[model samples]
Target: MSAMKEYALGVCYAHPKEMYDLYDLLCGWEIAERAVEMEIVERFGGDTYPSKDMFEIMQGIADILENIPDEEALVMLKMVSLITDKPDLMEEELSFWRGRCAA
Candidate 1:
């Protein structure tokens, strides 16, 4: 979680001064991930990945979280907890992924 700034969207603007550096920081973050995705296509992207795999699932949800306009993705996350009937564990898992997604 500490290296969240390294990812394209894994950051929270909880302070005022952060806004001043947002543009550059965000661009750098996105570029860094893009580079990795380019070099590690088998692991990071493409259609070969199975939907049931955790990495692929999380990546898909992360993409949804990153692209959507609002907190709408939270609803889908909530549905995951309902389907699993594990709200408590899902709560913590959601926090970690949200920290990872930072959406």
Candidate 2:
């Protein structure tokens, strides 16, 4: 399974009855993921972006819309869109991913 899927499964398992909490956890994960992506970009000093992954994640969240509800998914989608739209953020994430790939 993908890292995101694994994380989601873990969240579901950990909070089976707390759907709202699961949503919160997913949002938190996205925030942290974006932050790391930004830091990575600054660290690598690269101009390349990782928009594909951002979009993939956005789609993933969208896929969960039925389970999460439109309102909640919209909020998550907005966050994902904000991150994807920012070039600086994309660079940061790519820089980080590049480093990880190199390592």
Candidate 3:
């Protein structure tokens, strides 16, 4: 499946509150996918599938979450948690990204 569709599914699965609006989810997905593509290109010299650098991928995700509002950040945390299969890390990841924004 496409990255955007995979991201949307993860977000919907981990949604913390009320259902996310379709438009907002789609917009966020586009933003996230773009970030992923950029990171992939930067790290691998090509925008290829199955990124090899976990650190860069996480950095890309953190960057995306930091730019958006807190509410949207929660949704993104959920998506990241789902993708990473580490729900326990959500708050810590959020805090890390928030700290990066502060720095």
Candidate 4:
């Protein structure tokens, strides 16, 4: 299974524990869910610049997605869009992810 899927399904921590959680989960500073962090960026407006924390999450997301195969990442984004109320946000993120896809 892909790292993202494994993380999503609680199958395992595919990356280093620090990669999964920048702080609190490690440094006991701020523990935030990846999904919630994604929504934070969306709530702040996709076009607007991200705040520091949001940017951190965005970077983290990029690192996470990097571990996934391009096709799998696209499909995963599509699947997530179907179940999310914020399908548009997912689509927008998917577009961004597609651009960043390594292959």
- Alpha-carbon local distance difference test for all models: 0.34, 0.42, 0.43, 0.42
Kindly report which residue stretches of model 4 are placed more than 4 angstroms away from their true locations once superposed. Answer: 1-48, 81-103
- The runs of at least 3 residues in candidate 3 whose Cα sits more than 4 Å from the true structure, single-residue gaps closed, are 1-52, 83-103
Worst 10 residues of 4 by lDDT: 22-31
Off-target runs (Cα >4 Å) in candidate 1 are 1-52, 85-103
Taking all chains together, the TM-score of candidate 1 against the true structure is 0.25
Model 4 over residues 54-98: C-alpha lDDT tens digits? 566556645555666554444443344343444445445445434
Instruction: List CA RMSD, all candidates.
Output: 14.0, 15.2, 14.0, 12.4
lDDT of 2 by residue, 1-103 (tens): 9886575445433323333322332343444355334423433355534466554543444344446544343343333334554556645644543454344
By descending TM-score, how would the candidates be arranged?
A: 4, 2, 3, 1
Q: What does the lDDT read for residue 43 in candidate 2? A: 34
Model 3 scores worst on lDDT over the 10 consecutive residues at: 17-26
Question: What are the per-residue Cα lDDT tens digits for candidate 1 across 1-103?
Answer: 4353233232232321222222122222323233223223433346534333445434544543455333333333332323233334434544554454444
Please provide, for model 3 over 1-103, each residue's C-alpha lDDT reduced to its tens digit, 9 standing for 90 to 100. Answer: 9987686656544433322222122232324444434543544466444444544444645454454555455544445434233323434544544444344
Clashes of each: 0, 3, 0, 2
Q: Could you tell me how far off, in angstroms, the CA of residue 53 lies in candidate 3 after the best superposition?
A: 2.3
